[model samples]
Target chain A: MNGGLRHILLALLLLTGLNPAHAAEPIKIGSFLSVTGPASFLGDPELKTLQMVVDEVNARGGVLGRPVQLIHYDTGGNASDALRYVKRLIRRDRVDLIVGGTTTGDTLAVIPEVEREGVPLISLAGAIEIIEPVKKWVFKVAHTDRMAAAKIYEDLNRRGLTRVALITGDGGFDKSGREQLRQLAPEYGIQIVADESYGNRDTDITTQLTKIRASDAQALINFGFGQAPAIVTRNVAQLGIDLPLYQSHGVASQTFIDLAGPAAEGVRLPAAALVVAEQLPDDDPQKPVLLSYKNRYEAQHGPVSTFGGHAYDGIMIALAAVERAGGTDKAKVRDEIEKTQSFVGTSGIFNMTPEDHMGLSLDAFKMVEVREGVWTLVENAD
Target chain B: MLEQLFQFLVTGITVGSLYALVGLGFALIYNASDVVNFAQGEFVMLGAMTAISLVAVGFPLPLAAVAAILITIGVGLALERFAIEPSLGASVVTTIIITIGAAIFLRGVALLIWGKDFHALPAFSGDAPIHLGGATLLPQSLWVMGATVLLVVLVRAFLNKTLLGKALLACSVNRAAAQLVGINVRVMLRLAYGLSAGLGAIAGILIAPITFSSYEAGIMLGLKGFCAAIIGGMGNPMGAVAGGLLLGVLEALGAGLISSGYKDAITFLFVLMVLFFEPTGLFGHKSADRV
Candidate 1:
């Protein structure tokens, strides 16, 4: 470092240390999110929720008697960019902990960096692989695709739809969801009679649907995100397929309904309580939490997606860990995060453990159906 | 058995019509200026996004579609003037690279204007499916197919029968000779861009309901359309339309009968086979015709 800059940094540190009213330095929380790219739908709200939560925390006299500083960078959904920014967050910004990575690719790309640096990272991405086999110093708030698959299977079992056909998109999220569904099918007493896939950018999936139609499957599950799920919804209707259609939580937002138009009617999916916050019972523990997050987010950002709710749970979990740790010690904070238990947040009641970094279970997801162009809770998880 | 094949055929034809429109656009610009406008896909995206925006602002669907097509045509003309025309006398490879740059710029502009959200345009007709002997077809699919037939006929007539169209063709035949015959080569090139843009917009508007429209939607459609042009013969408009239909049918059958995983691979393998057997494309004429 230059002598002049080093001296200036030392002087600023001394000034903060000398201040009587606020002796403790601000705790630095770093983040890198896909705020402006194709996955912005996930990262934009994530960034917003992080900023809003940090602001609210600061307004409430900060965490542990010190101001919280959020140092964030927009990775634009690129994995390499996410890694570079994360390294900078650790080496340059010297943040105490991190609480972002909008997509699974971004999260996985920075996993090795955060692990080596011993910084606590609570990712917002949904892939189970992020936390599977338990990487120390890493936790994620979003319910993995495995949870989504189990929740859907639970719903299917309730309805006695034993034979299920799978149509998946050839994308990461869909491919993972497809794998989880296939692996968990036997456990759920469901048979995978037909399994087909389509390209992400395919315009027509009728041929695949037709093949599925010929199968004796009693239900259809589409594993995909983006507009492909919407297209599948439409094609199912056009082909006169009478089987029940279930979509993955990857498309739990109203944008899916808007894109699918009337075809979204009667489609079921496993989603967070945030999507149907108003419909939750008054006695439900997550009701107040979901409603507050929904109202606060919608008040400023127009709508609330489950993606943003994941961020809410993530930052809240991080701050709660920091408070429990009593200081910005990375090791202590990591342990505190792993010991998180029954913390009611928007996505679910997270109960992190040393073995399971992602604390959400099948109960975290509520089965929802599209009724009259709005999300209606089908079954509330107890 | 046969029912499955019939269903695949119906679906293939409906999707093929869209590829034909976009492939026809590629063929038009290629024939006019010998520069493969990679921005052709952006034209499709612009058309769909513009129409959706127009409808959102309370324009009727038909009127919005017309305005969208006109707006996309304007974008095409602007692209030709600002990006393509400026690099006059550049190598073919240079001009092609310029179009790729144009495509990226157009996509960026679209991302800024439309954001990253996928916007849906309501179907031109009701989405009620018509049962064709156990096979089902959407009303929008009919609109797409009928519109494709009408457009292909219109474009063919304009190119083969009209004076201005013939002048455009003459430029493709021999730019220097056409210039000597008092043909305004620049005007012909501009017309090709305008016409190609209009075709792309119509394709976008027609398929937006089925596929939905987003800033990135054009990338795949454009690539498929380019493949259609290649399979048909780059310079052959009729060949492009046929190539598009053939590719779509092959893809559908490949997915349905063989494996969905190899759908694209199978289609590309066929394309490669054709390219290997017939380097001039399925319908491309020999060099004697150009001379």
Candidate 2:
């Protein structure tokens, strides 16, 4: 060979030799959460769990022997901010996968962007719309409002509570829950006698409660989160209503019990098994994963909530997909995520399919009631 | 039907008392400084948050409440001194804008101090509901009404009977004339802020048990209170009480009878009607522009 040809061949060999080992890029995961705004209660814990899991995965050599990079932006519970950050993550960060959204409103805001970008997104929001008419690139880990409503109605049915009163807040979650209850109550053989709604900032719901009390309702089902539910609890007590109160999974945090105080006692809600992890039977499939997550999380943070478990499941599912796909190729990863089945996660045993983005079923929730400010498993209710 | 009416009435009165209390705060600040201190609602939030924190730290409820009111008074004085006093000779719009800025600043400060969690104070008495015919009323409702009435009486007496109160009114009527008469207009303004803040704090503490208090609670309460102030003639204290109660009752009735979803809409609609028809308000004097 000529001298020039020999030198070019040598340089090409050197470049090819270095490329195999060093060319694997880190998998970028972006998240837009309401870490500082009204929905911080949900976002803060979720971000913590994501960070902890990412650190643990990286410590274990990450997926496919490549490091995972997490890019998190605080959406501040605002839909516009969520859309802005989602665009930024896709355009600027070039993230391979995304996981976030504390509220349904924010999650819905970013759906079009995530779909158009073809980046696989696992939303942490509980709205069913995040998954319904399932988009190719979108999935959710949080139990949907429909699932929660079904669980609540099932419990009500078991108790033979045929007549129910619904008091929902005027937020997105509450509105969706109200719609689900209205649509699904007939299926569960329950009649909603009085459906009332109060403003999210309303101080007193006595008038609503009074109307409910006078109705033919045998029980009160309050579908809301935040201080409004607590205020409703207080109002129910103040109105001397003697009916049973069923809350949605929205108020699954200890903060709800704290805000409601003595009034929170005997209030039952459908929550993920992570809430009563220690009380789970030894044979329960989710117990070990739930307990481990609970311990790891509480060792650093104060308490572990199911909201955080949603993030854990989202991250774990994404990691598992990357591992199964053997690379961070966006299409391959998205297909693997869709094929996820029987993956034990902090939220539940995820079984993602092409038709079902949220792999969780109604069985993922256990009926839990507050006893002396602590979540206790309702006996034989699940 | 009677029972429903009674329940709505009870709710209206309770909420009206709170609106009145907040409206009075607005009026007090408007009278002295000719600037509507939009931060009036923050005083309420501070009162409830401070009181809750104190109570959490094991102070008696009464003592915590007193300390909360005192701290809010200090905050009001500081706001007047730092924010209002510096812009004394500014245009009325400028002063009003400054007050709005002050409100935003106070809310941000509160968010940092208390975080974003909602807090509740135990009712001053207990949680028992008093059975009145077919309607049940919380004991705290009575406490709220009683406190509002007592404050109204005390303020009426103060404004009518005391020299300091007269100086405040004199400042409100004519700042230059009051200054000419040797009244310290600055002191009167400071006192107005202090009293207004204290009044707002009292409203916060009284309503916190019922409403629950969060860092952002001030915005809605302040807006509604401002509406009450406008409804009752902006500069009239007694008019504020009447306007507040009227607005509250109307809101409760609307919610109880009409769709609850349209509760706020109905309330604001009434305010719009009032503003369109009676530009000055129900109790406002029919006079030309003072300036």
Best by lDDT: 1
Predicted complex 2: CAPRI docking category: medium
Question: What would the per-residue lDDT of candidate 1 be over residues A336-369, giving only the tens digit for each residue?
Answer: 9999999999988888888989877778888999
User: How big is the positional error of residue A39 in model 2, measured in Å on the Cα after superposition?
Assistant: 2.8
After superposition, the stretches of candidate 1 with alpha carbons farther than 4 Å from their true spots are A1-25, A36-38, A55-61, A64-66, A380-382
Local accuracy of candidate 2 as per-residue lDDT tens digits, A1-382: 3566445534544654645455346789999999877788789899999999999988987766568999999988999999999999999999999998888889999999988889999999988888889899999998888888998888888888899999999888899899999999889998989999899887778877877877999999999888999989988887878889999999887878888878888999999888889999999988999989999999998778888999999999999888777666689899999999998887778888889998888788889999988999997663
Query: How accurate locally is residue B4 in candidate 2, as Cα lDDT from 0 to 100?
Result: 84
All candidates: DockQ: 0.82, 0.64
How would you encode candidate 2's per-residue C-alpha lDDT over B1-85 as one tens digit per residue? 7898899888888788888888888988776766777889889889999999999999999999999999999999999999989
Q: What does the lDDT read for residue A381 in candidate 2?
A: 64
Q: What fraction of correct interface contacts does each candidate retain?
A: 0.93, 0.67
Each candidate structure's TM-score, on Cα atoms with residue i matched to residue i, is 0.94, 0.93
By summed lDDT, the worst window of 10 consecutive residues in model 2 chain A runs over A4-13
